[model samples]
Target: MPELALKKETGLKKETRSEELLQLVVFQLGEEEFGLDIMQVQEIIRIPEITRIPHSPDYVKGVINLRGKIITVINLDTRFGMEQKVHDDNSRIIVAEVDENVVGMVVDSVSEVLRLPLSTVEPVPEIISTKINANYLKGVGKLEDRMLILLDITKVIMEDAPSKVAYC
Candidate 1:
């Protein structure tokens, strides 16, 4: 419910425009396409300096004081077990609120927000013969050779990772 509330706060194009389908904020994580429920995103900020917290989880990049509110930041790349990349010009922070907790995830350049019909949203593929974790994906959105990995943001952040991340 909070996620839905967050989406409402985003002031994304009205659902009526998409015929009641949820709007998806698409972005790039490495070479893959990822989508987030537009409502969950609070803001898109250019990547900022993240102070690493000693003894914290490897995926936890650090914390940021956003308008006086301390928010934990996560490196989605590390969380997803991908190679960590230095934040650059094309990098961004997608601030999303989940269950009242707002966290920022580092990502490659953001693409665009598109309307994804719920009917077109299918379950994630069962083959981890693939490159990503199925639990993090809600489904795939097909678009003329490009497939957007529809993300279940809460699941991606809240669920136990498929494997433990080795701390550097």
Candidate 2:
């Protein structure tokens, strides 16, 4: 019957779509674990010598010359309203490309690459902390005992980041 054929086609389409999985680059920010789309990340590099820019935003740590290309580096901890700590051996800069901008995000450390089903991700709740700009979140992904907070790279870099400098 036509109905049976249509149902089979629809089921096939659903299976095809469901097969697409999200690949995340996991990292640690203080005690919390966060993830970003691996496709958005160009590469991860050690904390290089950063040249501070005059009159730059508080969250903007400065610019770094990676290999030969200069890239703007943002302090993720400060941007999230977390306490600023001195960079250590574990510190790393995740070079991310969102839209036309290629910037380095300084995180405490890099963890691992996670591949999970898209269905496991859930949108953030209405009640969230003001410290972190919730509008920039993709969702929280549940995987066994791990709860990963997925951040929207575009929104976080383009929208939530403070444009003004913080006067010390």
Candidate 3:
């Protein structure tokens, strides 16, 4: 049951579209895996140098020059009230489109793109002990050995935005 051996056993490749599910891009923050709609993801890039903007919230990591366009980067862990982590070489920025605007999210690592069928996706249940609000989550999805929290990206961002940002 060593970590490496367990990974090897679970790493067997499968056909991309197995007629049951659509692919999702998976990434990690702390110990949990979360997913966003694959079609919403523009690209994954290395941690870029961000220009800090004064008067912004701690979760707003600042802007990055992506091919000459400035995009805001948000730290998911911080937004969720988790302790901030120091960035390392393995850290990544996942660019996703919401409300026609491209935003980058920082994650500890990108795991894989998985194809999950509609049947495997379930409504987010009303769990009394859940720490985060349900508006930020679309649903819970079950895949082979994992359960992913599918994010409603637009809602997540909108819920935290200032009145000015929300209308823009």
Which model scores highest in TM-score?
Answer: 2
Q: What overall lDDT, based on C-alpha atoms, would model 3 receive against the true structure? A: 0.80
**Which lDDT tens digits does candidate 2 get at residues 1-168?**
999999999999999777868999999998889999999999999998999998777789998888888788989998889998799999999999877678899999998998978988889888876588887788999999989899997887778443432221
**Residue ranges of candidate 2 with Cα displaced over 4 Å:** 1-18, 160-168
TM-score of each: 0.79, 0.84, 0.81
lDDT of 2 at 69: 80
**Model 1: per-residue Cα lDDT over 66-133, one tens digit each:** 78877778888987888778778999999998666678888988988888777666677676465457
- The lDDT per prediction is 0.78, 0.86, 0.80
45: Cα error in model 1, Å: 0.3
Worst 10 residues of 3 by lDDT: 159-168
Per-residue CA lDDT of model 3 for 27-119, tens digit only, reads: 888888898889999999999788877777777888888999888888888877777778788789999887887888999999899877878
Query: CA shift at 134, candidate 2, in angstroms?
Result: 1.1
Distance (Å) between predicted and true CA of 38, model 1?
Answer: 0.6
Query: How well does model 2 score by local distance difference test?
Result: 0.86
TM-score of 3: 0.81
User: Rank by lDDT, descending?
Assistant: 2, 3, 1
**Candidate with more favorable, higher lDDT: 2 or 3:** 2
